[model samples]
Target: MGYVMQPSRPIDWIRNAIRYTRHSPKRLDVFKKCVKAEKIDSKALLCLDIPTRWNSTYKMLDRAQKIEKAFNAFDLAHPNYRNNLRDGVPKVTDWSYARKLRNLLELFKHKTNNASATKYVTVNMFYIEMMDIYTHIRNMKGIDPESRLMADAMQNKFDKYWGTNNKGLNYILYFAAILDPQSKLGVLSFGFACVFKAEKKERDQRGT
Candidate 1:
């Protein structure tokens, strides 16, 4: 019984932080500043059957399943809670994640790379989980020094990893996603000089 109580305080704190952060002006500013506009190539992503992305296929499935379960728990905990929700909510069960997990488990059992639809589903599941965590942190409130420090650290990491003009994680993923499978020269890398130009073009096109 005492063991059960251990998680309550932290969970409640996280929940309250999540709720309050969803409405903060700082959070909104961060969202507008950090959320990048890019295309996701689900079909192409499915083609890359890289097992190194995860320790093992079974591990990948297990992690993805846990993520799915976490999402489900959060969903049931807060129905109609769209304050910080996105396309990644409800963490669909028996879907891509599950299929990939099952495929991965099979792969581990058989040691085969012929898993046709395994790659994209697992990758998408990861992307979704990361997006949710990032969004949650972006919208979270920091009332204490520790929380504020943690928030700042997370924000800085996001900015460092994904907030570059040309060589950012976003740019890498975008280029990779849109790569021509047959072409070695068609894929373009964004230069710092062109990043602003592309951003402006995107904004103008979006009428934002």
Candidate 2:
């Protein structure tokens, strides 16, 4: 579960690298003015991520990516900027990775927001969302070698929580899917057939 435990490492490093710029009032004001000049529809200040919240991290990276050029400009124009950030600033690759990671995390952010909605019952969404997350992890695994590592870690955690043998794999999730009007027993049967290659009787027994 390296990925699950450390998904924010890179973002944390980037944040640390730019901590001075983010905290410096002079640099922040200059960065804000530069963003205004460019007419970029972004906040006037950089967002520091809250450690406990993933969505806040996403928002921080998203805003940082948008104002990357402004940060560069500020760095170049401000005297003693390099001295202030002695630990080294984020490079182009770091920013690029942040952008990619932000995109990758968008699905989770959206799902989290949707699940928190108060207007409707969210139980029906559990099955589909879990499947969607599973597929997304698989896709990430196939994307590239680096992503493969992250995906592998995530997959390990996913299986730990939802694998056939895991206690977290309750029958209610399957029953919920079967109860959905759009995807009834047909979808459930197909899914079970794929997951459990045993006889129909065995699968039914497990379900019951």
Candidate 3:
């Protein structure tokens, strides 16, 4: 996989754009008015992302995408829209990248929500969920070079945690998965074989 040493451009752009918009009452008002005019859901407000939380970034992008048309109109109606912003305003390409980022982050969002469910025991499911995350990060093919760079940066972090010496492949996780009736040893065996590229016999021996 490709390596990117810089910060994720799409995320940085979104963070700056949101901060810039929130700082300007006139721009924010125009955004709200446009949302109302467009008959978008009232909850579809442009939310600012918390620097610490990935899910909040997902929410910010999702909301921003919903109001993209409004931003487009605002840019056309106000010639000074871009100039007035403290940071550079988001362009159409930035908005498109946000949509792509949102889609990719949705998988993590859903996994996080599921893990947070209080009613069910989620321990056995964690192994599968983490594997899914690893697979998703590894398989990502971004829409453009910038998006690809962002994905590569994320993948690098994921690899640090899960790859190299297969540190993430703990026996406890497999044991927990095997103990769950819904996903027994057979499932664990198959999963190990696929992820580690181990032979079926080796996977079965490991499971045993």
TM-score of each: 0.25, 0.78, 0.75
Ranking by TM-score: 2, 3, 1
lDDT of 2 by residue, 75-165 (tens): 6777566666654567787788889878877776887787788999877777677767777776786677777786767777777876666
TM-score, structure 2 vs. true: 0.78
Leading candidate by lDDT: 2
Tens digit per residue, CA lDDT, model 1, 130-163: 3444454444323445344444555555445544
Clashing residue pairs, backbone N/CA/C < 3 A, model 1 = 21-139
Clashes of each: 1, 0, 0
Query: Which stretches of model 2 miss by more than 4 angstroms?
Result: 1-13, 50-53, 192-208
Q: List candidate 1 segments past 4 Å from native.
A: 1-121, 125-127, 164-172, 175-208
- Displacement of residue 165 (Cα, Å) in model 2 is 2.2
TM-score: the better of candidates 2 and 3: 2
Name the lDDT of candidate 1: 0.37
lDDT value, residue 86 of candidate 1: 44
Model 1: per-residue Cα lDDT at residue 140:
38
TM-score of 1: 0.25
Error of 3 at 98 (Å): 1.7
